[model samples]
Target: MLSWRRSTSATAPGSSLAYGCADFLGGPGARKAHVLRTVMVAAPAGLAVELLLWPVLGASFSGAPLGWGAASGAASAAAFALLHRTLAIGPMNVLSPVTALVSAALPVGVALLHGEHLGAAGLVGLPLALVAVVQVGAGHGAGVARPSRTALLLAFGAGTAIALQLIFLHQAPSDSGVAPLITGRAVSSAVTLAAAGQMHRRLGAERPAYAMSAAASVLDSLANLLFLLAARNGDLTVVAVITALYPAGAVLLARGVLAERVHRGRLIGLGTAAVAVSLLALT
Candidate 1:
């Protein structure tokens, strides 16, 4: 059910025709619609795939790890809603990386609290990650409006939910496999997506809106699969860090195809994030 294909914008062959067509037919609104559809489709599909992969943990379905994951996802969605309204920041540019950073840090901190000795490499990655986060945040400030106090707290709450979700994923029985974990993700995502649909209805849905959500949903599903696989098989901290780099993907796509100009600082921060990804993965 993966509809997303890898296509480059600048250097890829057969770009001129598509670019001309999009320029002729798909304007800014078309792009916005694309983004919205991507969200709706990818978010739900991603969750479903994750749940399908993770075996349910605990006896009762609601008592399983998926349940808690669903809860965490709901919390995250709420946080997103708050941000969309109050902060006016877009999802990929601001929300995705921020959540990824918090999710990565949380598990590491939790592991330490549980008396797990982090490798020296992990210890080193921590401060570098912190610096990377600050840089990303500073970069985001250029295009997006500053979050108000309420929006900031709510956004933090979203990050907390994601962090807790990862922590719980790590805490879940290893034998639980992919079914339960992916199920949890699916449930959470379903709730969030349904809510988003409602919000869109209220906000007014247009052609571009539908397309963007559809695209996001597809991307989200793919990301979800990658993250779930990474989490189940790899170190949670490392997995979280790598997945957090998704924003860079979005930014690059925007710049390349959409021709959206990024602030230099944001570009630098994203570059810093890329370095952090390399360092975290190696460690």
Candidate 2:
């Protein structure tokens, strides 16, 4: 079970969802070692995929995106390591709160920096993005607690990577192709796994944790791929904001599978986030 400083996230709704999925898939048990292995291999694969896709997408190919991608990737890897170490320190609700918020707003900052005018849609989504974040916090508060300093720092670092990714995506040359982006996903997955391996050894995780971590890496890559596709097809603001609902997906998974407690706050938070999404998109 993934422990936090103050919270036990093993039974967290999000955790439950993942556990249930593994059980449903009937592939393996949800042990720490398994989670770790899953994370180690799958995470970097996602990044590698993104890197390869950028060139094919016809976007202005530049090393700048890769540079920033590396930084963000490192930050994310650090975050995962921290999560493993501080599993017993904080609540899943607490740890996951601001990540999406940071991610959702990052693209807007990138667009503005690049002098892309914010449309009405952009204006609408901004506030909803905040609301959505609040919902995540409320929903996960039940068994959550304050994280260790290391966890907090890692969380911030992860947020930074996510934000940087959005900026890079926004700044990617208009003519950029999707090939490199996909390639990046695969490469990054490998990188993440290596980092996870180092951390696994440090933490001495068991088999189940390794598997879960591996699964997380793969899923995270798929999520990134979806985000890229969404960006390719939809407005940045819309795509970013909608995908920010990922934590909600994680939370929902917990409710159905882990038999974890779902707080009313989560319902309200999700509802608020939904309202924000609708308002943001419509505007």
Candidate 3:
């Protein structure tokens, strides 16, 4: 769960869709610690889901790649913690886009380094995707306050961490099934618990908050499971870019649930991202 201050005026458009999703999870008092705590609590539930679905999905597992999965989970936890913290403490508009761009770019770079070729369409679409991410990250309206440099750096680092997590997960063998995901959830939970302890935050006496956190955790786990499956069979570049469009879901949520106005800039960015993703798929 993540939360931040909401702007009163429509002129601001305040948080981006990513932050909007966080808002749903944590509400106005949502901060870095709360977000981490939610993730920590959700880990076990996510693991359970993976285990339950394994038999139905007919997924097989091997212990050999558990280490890789654990590593990926650790990186993912770190990324989420850092990213939520950045979002909580900084401008959502700027940080979200910066993080999204880096998250998308790194996997593509990794794919290229591994001799994965991007056809002409992919080459063109890559830049377009970057541009779209930037547009979405920038505030929805003119005259918006600029995001701090520290926030930008934090977001970038978070995105890199997420990229590493994705790359590692992609390396897992298909037969490994959701075992890596389970390993990742366990690792992330432990790390987040430690972080919560250090911060001296207690997840107590807030029933609604707990419920929201639990929901977020379940959704996040499902997302991770699906992503792992997708990356296993698809090109990492394609999967990463497509997955990076998750903020668009946040935007839609914001509009429908929060009644937030979707400005032209964001709409354009989202539309551009859709086109860019389509191009990537074709390539």
* Each model's lDDT: 0.50, 0.52, 0.69
Writing each residue's lDDT as its tens digit, candidate 3 over 5-57 gives 22211101121223335435654323433454555556666677767765655
Q: What RMSD value applies to candidate 3?
A: 8.3
- Indicate which candidate wins on TM-score: 3
Worst lDDT 10-window in candidate 3: 3-12
Q: Give the per-residue lDDT digits (tens) of candidate 2, residues 1-283.
A: 1111221111122222332243332234334344455555445544554455444444444676555444544444454555444444555455556555666677656655655554676576567666766576544344446666666665555555665665455444433345435435544556665656677656454544444445554455445444544454445655555555556665666677677676777777778766666555553
Candidate 1 vs candidate 2: the lDDT winner is 2
lDDT of 1: 0.50
Candidate 3 residue-wise lDDT at 177? 64
Report the poorest 10 consecutive residues by lDDT, candidate 2: 1-10
Q: Between the candidate structures 2 and 3, which one is better when assessed by TM-score?
A: 3
Name model 2 segments beyond 4 Å from true: 1-31, 34-36, 41-72, 82-88, 117-124, 139-151, 174-176, 196-205, 209-216, 233-235, 258-261
- TM-score, cand. 1 vs. native: 0.66
Model 3 misplacement above 4 A: 1-33, 58-64, 142-144, 201-208
